[model samples]
Target: MTEPGDPRFGATHRRFVIPTVISRATIGGSTCQIVVGVLSSGSATQRSQRGELRAELLRIALRGQGLADPCTVGVEHDANGAPALSSPHIGSVSFSYDGIWAVVAISPSEGRIGVDIQMPRRVSPTVLRRFAPDLATRADDKSTYSEFARRWAAREAASKAAGTGLRGELLRTVLPVARAGRDFGATYTVLDGWTFPALSLAHKD
Candidate 1:
């Protein structure tokens, strides 16, 4: 595993392929990698296939991090359904999927990480208020769907990193601006002409 302050610790690398590795960046004290890919329409609803794809994406991420036999690494989930490295323990991980896109994020075990991706869609005021009331109050008639998705992604990512999975009052408590740089990061990107709102959050150990 790479140490916290190693010169290569925070460096990011990228690749464009069927399962594209969007980008990697330093989050908190760990280097976090994000991978994005498309799932066949037929298998999108197959739980087993989705699981396999997530694992494959993880292996690809580990390989990119210079792991010798990434395929040997095991994956297990916690009680909250959060994924983690089960064997040859190397780092923390998170997963998100929307429509046909599957995204996986991995970071050194030093810190907890969470990631989320949302496809473009209309976010009604009621829905927005339920998820992020403060944001709703601040949002005007001009707020775009992408903006709503981004905020929602940020909250989801934060909740995942904290291992709380959108339950209780946590969703409303995670403010967009407060966590923007402290432990939050988000972006909107286009892949194959499809717009995706993605974000990640890291909680330092």
Candidate 2:
């Protein structure tokens, strides 16, 4: 695995997975890559419950590029509401979906990686009211739910990244919006931005 301070993710470091195909990109440039062949492609429930194992496997493969072990993810809901990985080398990796996508990300440095898989769908005020009662107060812009999602995703990712459950860190918990100048929600505000590669696989059944 690549060391935390390797600078592989820096701007000077190439992003082969995004600009070039993973096959063509150098191994180091693709520490993160999407896994294909999903067992279920259209349902978050299937992806979350079933594809999780496959997703981690792909994550391992991505880590292998950096010479790190992708390792296995253990499912244990903590009081904080984030999923936890049993391995230390795995860094902070989290799994999630938007009823349409299965996604994951790893933080090679902060051990605070977070990613969210979201499907493009219409949002209702009621759903927002249930998850985020403070929506009307945050921003009146068009992407209010998206903002909520970002916050929710970040909460989930951060908690999971720290191996803490999401039970304690819900929206109402009132934790800081960011850490070290990095907005832990929606994206990695710490390093200016964060990109997580997702892998999807299908079940033979």
Candidate 3:
């Protein structure tokens, strides 16, 4: 678990093999930074409060980046259901929560961005077959539940960035690359003492 200000925080693992913490990415020459935070007590018990912590963290991130006060920032869903920031300089804000942890990604430039964080758990074969058949095919002999969760996290994160949110065929979507034994290009990692698959994307037009 690394603190927000630690040197290693907000670094990108871009090797396409392993997960990263507080990771970052570049799109169209602009950089997007992701900040990870623990879920709030209210968020843990109340389903409605799930996004509160992430949103607040986003506000903090924005402010630190020299944006307006978090209270003044607006988070609204697009026609496609992707989250966007109201501020002009800060292009987009995306968040993901998995009951235990929350992550917020902010694009410093004009690119769109999204993020997702998921706690690794046992995934049943049936669920895998429905959501990710490819993973199902190889998971048994070559992959573990953790790997499945990591790949799922990548898909979810990419979906969020695309502003589609699993509306399309999971297999047809852009599958995030994860090397068999190394980390690269949007892999997952741990942050703030939480072991989870965290992903971020910064896309340019």
Highest lDDT: which candidate? 1
Looking at candidate 2, the ten consecutive residues that score lowest on lDDT are 18-27
Model 1 quality (TM-score):
0.74
What is candidate 2's lDDT per residue for 1-205, written digit by digit as tens?
Answer: 2122222222211212112112111111224332212223333355344454344434543554464544444544456565445654544444555443444444333334444433323446665566666664544555664555454554554444444445543544533234222222322322212222321111000
Assess each prediction's global lDDT (C-alpha) against the native.
0.62, 0.38, 0.55
Better of 1 and 2 by lDDT: 1
How well is each residue in 28-61 modelled by candidate 1, as lDDT tens digits?
Answer: 6566766766676577777777777777778767
- lDDT for model 3, on a 0 to 1 scale? 0.55
lDDT of 2 at 50: 47
TM of each candidate vs. truth: 0.74, 0.46, 0.68
Query: Which tens-of-lDDT digit does each residue in 38-147 have in candidate 3?
Result: 54344476654555555556665675566655678888777877777776666777777776566777777665555666666776777777656666666565345665
The model with the greatest TM-score is 1
Q: Which pairs in model 1 have colliding backbones?
A: none
Ordering by lDDT: 1, 3, 2
lDDT value, candidate 1, whole model: 0.62
Report the backbone clash tally of model 3.
17
